[model samples]
Target: MVDSPRIAIDAMGGDTGLAVMLAGAEAAYRQDGALRFLLVGDEAAIREALTRHAELAEASEILHAPDRIAGEDKPSQAIRRAKTTSMGLAIDAVKTGRAGAAVSAGNTGALMAMAKLALRTIKGIDRPALAALLPTLGNNDVVMLDLGANTDCDARNLIQFAVMGAAYARSALELAQPRVALLNIGTEELKGTDEVRDAAAMLRQADYLPLQFTGFIEGDRMSRGDVDVIVCDGFSGNVALKTIEGTARFVADLLRRAFTSSLRSKIGFLISRPATELLRHHLDPNNHNGAIFLGLNGLVVKSHGSANANGVANAIRLAARLVRDDLTRRISEDLANFDTHKGPEAVTA
Candidate 1:
């Protein structure tokens, strides 16, 4: 077990700058006083921000990082500055054992590049995938992976994603046997590309694994609460994620427009104000703010750049929970089990 895991925050990474980052850290500290922080950014600015949250001040340490990674910076460019940048140093802390995990609301690509370079992938895994918890109609949230980490993935990558995703579901969602599925064009056995079909064939035969392989899941069925984990290449995963987010926003805006269309509609909205408030809370992206880079040697969480303090806190909470649960070890063990069972070779054949 990780003893007293401390989360390293990239204070200068996001769109909201240091204020939101510090506030988010403070909010997380408030929720879990046992949590400690390593604030990485301009020393003077971070010190000034800490003055507002006495509790966080007591539980935190400041690390001076003279530079910051911009949102538009290329991954290659960002990697070059990893040594001096706040986002880079925060991830580096995890690699060096100074921190258990890193949290940043920075460029997703940069974080992925820096993290993969600094910590490297766990053995038996070729590449790391980005996974996030999305609110679903099911009793629990669904975990989806390869959210733009690797645009093109082969059968092996998808298989690795499923194992990592299952481990994450068990660790983060406390699921006993997560039902896993490949995101495909159709649920039929013969549908989807060759890579997906091959992966499915392998997963279907491997009943010995901890996760439940439920076969292919189409795009339309993603939010239906039938599966616990959805695996796909980054290209498809990113497109699906953006589509879902856009749809949510569209629905929310439509409701707003309808509610104030006329005086009668306004009154109706007020009468149903409580219900709408609940809906708003449920649909709020801030409530589900963290996206994790799985299959890495250390933990690194990516918070939405526009997220508020509450969102940042949620991301931090996720990182802390994963650390407490020993997520990295769990994934490693799962991968080892898969390899021992000859999962890859059996699937390929």
Candidate 2:
């Protein structure tokens, strides 16, 4: 009976389906005995899965949801079916204060649409951004935002993302006075679009904020580990994120082929197995499994749809950490303190 925050899980959402979700929940419960769960999905399937893990059954409560949003469903289509769907019910748990946060390995667009509609944006936020931790060459992970949430954004939107992203870095990465930057094609002050320039100007003038605004950062410098939080609209952020992931896979495949190409290479690979394993562990997507919908009233973490049990467990842990750390309150407080003239108050009613 270790007491911890309860997280809502959309049990029918992932690629591997209910069994993997339950297995992940069991793994999370085993790793952190304090954590509790609200498993939302088909009651029969959930119960069947739960029987395999008695301890998880003890720690979890199932909420039967007759339907589930599909991976191919568009955001517009998904939002209309919110009431009957597992993803919607999981998010509703957060809205109704029944759960501290919601975790889903579901349709990314659908999850975002449902969350935004159900929880609404935080008072000072214009749009919620999808933020995630990316492994960096430095000592800690870098927080990058608008990973695919808002494809088009203005200067004010970018500024809000900066504040939210910085607050998230503080809460999740345990960083003090995080260094923030805008992602642009060039590092020059005069480069990039008017939106980027305006956002940079605003951030640079925001001296009262807790984060240090380091002007512009080019995409090539992203992995250098100097900046803590990187902000950009969804279009570029998504492209950058996908490019990095593809490059990682390309390098990994090359390594595999090279190692098996020759007998001598295979021998060398055998000798370097330990180092290679360490590299694989570090680069595995499961280690960085959660992508958060920031700027919302509550925490909503979207795990990769194809994630295994280990990845789902990591996502659950992330939601739990944010809940315990009170991430929403921190973001709200930060926004409240922002100058009204330049904040969301100026743009939104």
Candidate 3:
């Protein structure tokens, strides 16, 4: 009987369609009993899925969207059809105040495009960055942003990202004063490009901010958990994100081969099964399934297009958390300070 925000789901937007979406909703409801859902998709298909998930039916409402945006659809094309697409309708629900947040396991680019158009950027934010909680050695996850949204950014843009990222950490991580850093080739102030250095300088001078700017962080040190939030341009951020994911997979595959290479190795694996199980749980992508489009006037969480039920549920849970935290409002208040510190010229420049 915990009352919480209602979330809008693009039920037809995921790879597995109605069944997976409904299953994810059910799982999320079980995890967070406070959740309510607005399932958007073809009514008949959603109803069919509901038949298989009675618990979700009681906690959900159906909103029919006959059209869907395909994986290959361009953002331009998707935005044009936003009024009819399931993804678009879900975003609209947030803009129209019917839902607190929206979650979609759809085309990343299209979702970004449609969300930017519908939600728009919060005042003083020139762009929105894709941010997510990356598991770190520390007990908590680190916030990394500009995962693939802008590709290229200026000093001002990086500064904006830093502000947005800090706001996110405050909301999602519940940190009163999150330590922030800029990703650089080296830790020295003289290292890295002009944009990163400039962003660092601006952050250092912003005395009014709540977050602590700890200066430059080398790429190699990202997982050490010393920094609470990491800021980078999209190109570098995307590369770093992919490298982490690839490395994780490569290690997993190597472990599998090593464990099965011989009978003695297999025996050792069995003896160490519990430890390996813990490693598996920590490395699982489903545990960190939501990538938030921060800086938008309304919150939108993008699920991995191929995410399974568990992954989708994690995404939905993330959306609900952001809603309850009032992430957008927090970002807006901080963004205003960012503009004040930078002045009109620096912000517009």
Predicted candidate 1 versus true structure: per-residue lDDT over 96-191, tens digit per residue: 989999999999999999999999999888889999999888898999999999898888899999999999999889998999999998888999
TM-score of each: 0.97, 0.97, 0.97
- State the RMSD for candidate 1: 1.5
Distance (Å) between predicted and true CA of 335, model 1?
A: 0.8
Using alpha carbons, what is the TM-score of model 3? Answer: 0.97
Name the 10 consecutive residues with the lowest summed lDDT in model 3. 340-349
Off by over 4 Å in 2: 1-3, 340-349
lDDT of 2 by residue, 1-349 (tens): 2149999999999788898888988899999999999999999989987889899999999999999999899999999989899999999999999999999999998999899999999987889999999998999889999898888999889988998999999988898799999999999899999999999988887887789999898888898899999999999999999999999999999999999999999999999999999999999999999999998889999999999999999999999999998999998887876755455554332
Model 3 gets an lDDT of 0.90
- Leading candidate by lDDT: 1
Question: What stretches of model 1 exceed 4 Å from their correct place?
Answer: 343-349
Ranking by lDDT: 1, 2, 3
- Sort the predicted structures by TM-score, highest score first: 1, 3, 2
lDDT of 3 by residue, 1-349 (tens): 1158899999988677777878898999999888999999999988887888998898999888989999899999999999898999999999998999999999999999999999888887788999988999998899998999999899888888888899889878889999999999998889989988888888888878889999999888999899999999999999999999999999999999999999999999999999999999998888989999998889899998788899999999889988988889888888777667667677533
